[model samples]
Target chain A: MSSEPRIFDPDEHDDVHLETELPEAELSDEAWETAALPDDLLLLGDQLRCDATRLHESHRADRLQHELLRPERAQRAETLVPARGISAWLPLLWLLPVVLITAALVSNGQPTVPRIPASPAVAVTPSVTPQAEYSPQVYSVSLPAETPSQHGPSAAELDALLDLMQNETASVAVSL
Target chain B: MKICGLDVEKLTSLYFDRIHRAALLMSGNAWDADDLAQEVFLIVANDPTKFEGRSSHYTYLYGILLNLERRLRRKRRMHQEKTEKLAQRQDGPTAAVAADVPVVSEEWKRSLWSVAAELPDGQRQAIVLRFGEELPYQEIADILGCPLGTVKSRIFHGLGTLRKLVAESPGQLREIPRELGDAQSDVI
Candidate 1:
């Protein structure tokens, strides 16, 4: 039952010959590092190296045991769940409305075309009172027989002033 | 545990650290890396014949891990697209504490690793096998199924992209390389 893979031999392969033919194709770790980079890139390279170093320092086959023991079907069942939550209920969801409508129709008797109620008749009413005949009366204007003539004061009407003027005796006393 | 002469349990005990670290590197999330690593072993355990006596054990394991990671990456991408509008963005590989590096360097490291996660499959494989796992050029070539020189070339280009990306955008969520990101979507 020892079906071990035959360890590859460089002598058996022509690739070893090709390796020498194309020296430019290969890059060693030292050569890779020695290749020039910008200052920023150099810093970043060291940082990546630190990251790789951390990865290198530790190891574990944490999931191998579980992966070996676990059934592939069970794993697929977990991920390939075509339906969940709403999807599981989707068919029933699609059928629900039809079921409800059918049940209501059965309980309520044969399905009937609901009649359209006649639109209410609009009533018309005549105004009761007639508009009164509005007639304007003719207006007449009359002049008084004699609008009393406005009269200025005569010498006789101004008796005391006329007497003072006729006598001229009281010129000092009567300042007309 | 011991399927044929594979000795999967012993293999797990042997290279668990290396594979796990590579997974973590490929996926910047510890949880995702763990899942990816375990899936690699599970896949091997299921089909021991898939791994013949062709390459190093680590190479075989890494090849599986890479395939699984790529598949997972594509799956995550498609899932993101499908649920992109679900009021919440799909959760991505977020290794807030992937390494116990200094807090100051965490953002830069996270950014660098995240960008590395987006490299093309071959280049990413070469880079991870080289820098992430600290594997030699020959070993990387074996794991990547490429010539040593091709492995080197991939590493050169991959590191160039990483260096440029880290230089340009070190502490931000870098954009996925459109040209190369989806190139290996069908690899797995």
Candidate 2:
């Protein structure tokens, strides 16, 4: 046995030394190639390789194949079922825009603010001071004063009144 | 040539058992291992294009499995913490109990595996990848997303831990070879 200091040289080819140090049957090719590692570590590596091989061999490969690798068509069908369910209502989706527009028009036509009561008690009155330059014209519209229980006008009537008021205002401005 | 343009069947055939074994070792149980393996394969199946062939396909698969394992571990840790808190609240000042007991069985491999499972996640992963999967240090480094030296250090420390654990139970050492036993002292 050469007890002399062996220099760390990759070039020094020693097949016999390698064979004696790492038996072919026990250690793997990778373990054999890692010559720099200690013999004990190499032995551990061999043990590891053997253990891994045993574990690998013990697994049920068929079970994995059956679970993971089903036919493409079956897989596609499984996946597409949800999408097909969604697509069944494709005709209904076209009505979305129409429904949305109708909602918008209905909302726009409705008066946002509720009409104030005609009762003078709740009506906000403007205080006027008597002065020669402060003389203002007052216009009064007669109302058929009714109890709060009676409905005043339908929404359509209110809309018609609003349109008539707007037209009158435009005509007065044109005349002016 | 390919399963849905991904060569998944080929990759699966090549590395399925290895991955499953790695998962088994990582999870410390067959049920979790099955779930982990199924999750890994599902990810690969869903988007096979993510594997760009930069590293070996096995390394790529292991990387995905490791990420999934980390997530699973995080969830397990959270659940454990909540359980511990609840336990403390309900049963005040309870003594800590050891999770792993010495194996009464004669099989040293099962004992060894259980001890390996007791190791910290990084060390356990290193040991499993090195010994259980037979991956080289560089490949382990790639799979772990760490430096080569880090991988070596992890394996060394992991093996040292395993050696200590096995030594704790003298009865388990009956099957260990003399040289391997001697090598235990040499492990730094």
Candidate 3:
């Protein structure tokens, strides 16, 4: 296929005009000289550009090196992890003691409670024992009837005892 | 400061003409031309990615320069317009043709460059590729990412306009008046 574009004259329909104008001055020596430019201005920019590119690439390499070699937060993150297999089991270890205690308590509850043992005492000899006939020299001395006697604590007395105990105890004990 | 793939010192020795010509073609002012070329180097040095291997290194660099010129033009238009207004105000009443005109030698070149600058972007690009770089039409089209006909039109129109501008300037064969010299005159 041809790549050239078709040229259409639009002047027929659009009433457009096409004019080819020519330069008035024949090329003068001075004009030619003026048109020719200093070769340095052209290349200076590109040369500097090349130097700049080298510098940039050097800096970029340095930056990449820095990025790759620099210490990262990930290193500290690794440090945050416990060392060895022991570290892996640390949580389960803490839970083991609690589990043992709970299991022991639970197992203990499954068994019946042991009965309390009765007191054991050996028989003693009755020699030199006083008989009821000796009257046991029994004498009753009564506390003064009119005077108030200290006896088993009264309901009011017992209440006062408990009130004092309650006062002395910490709030924590009461809450419990 | 640096352009990758191009050796700065070596390019300074070898390719400065090419870079300067490209700049001149893009920017009509010589001073601006040099500055633009320098700026292109800086761009290439700073970010070589802009030159992505779509064309020859020089062509890619040329593209960068042209784009930069456009951006600079947009940025400075308002400021330049204002400055021109101010300058006109300052110099208008006193402006006079010198009795002894000096250096008519470069008048043609300066006028030609000015006319080239006034060419539309597409046409100017076509001329730059065709004449400045001497690129073939297909390569020009490829570089411009345009149809072949468009490139042809650009070259034709660009040359036509430059010819008209030169023909119309003072001390010319044609009756090229100020009105005809105005930038808005349609493509013919």
lDDT of predicted model 3: 0.55
> How displaced is residue A16 in candidate 1, in Å?
14
- Best DockQ goes to which candidate? 1
> In candidate 1, which residue pairs clash?
A5-B53, A6-B53, A25-B152, A25-B153, A26-B152
Cα lDDT tens digits, model 2, A1-176, are 98999787765445323423323224443543353345444544455556556555554554567667668657888888755555667899999999999888877899656889796667668999766676688999999987777457777777877788877865422211
Off by over 4 Å in 2: A1-176, B1-5, B92-109, B173-188
lDDT of each: 0.64, 0.65, 0.55
True contacts kept of each: 0.23, 0.14, 0.01
**Model 3: runs farther than 4 Å from truth?**
A1-176, B1-14, B25-29, B84-111, B172-188
Those runs of model 1 whose alpha carbons end farther than 4 Å from true positions after fitting are A1-20, A24-47, A55-176, B1-6, B85-111, B170-188
| DockQ of candidate 3 compared with the true complex | 0.01
TM-score of 3: 0.40
For model 2 chain B, the run of ten residues with the poorest summed lDDT: B97-106
Q: TM-score of every model?
A: 0.48, 0.48, 0.40
Q: Per-residue CA lDDT of candidate 3, range A38-111, in tens?
A: 22212222232343334334434655887886677557767997555556667788899899998889778884
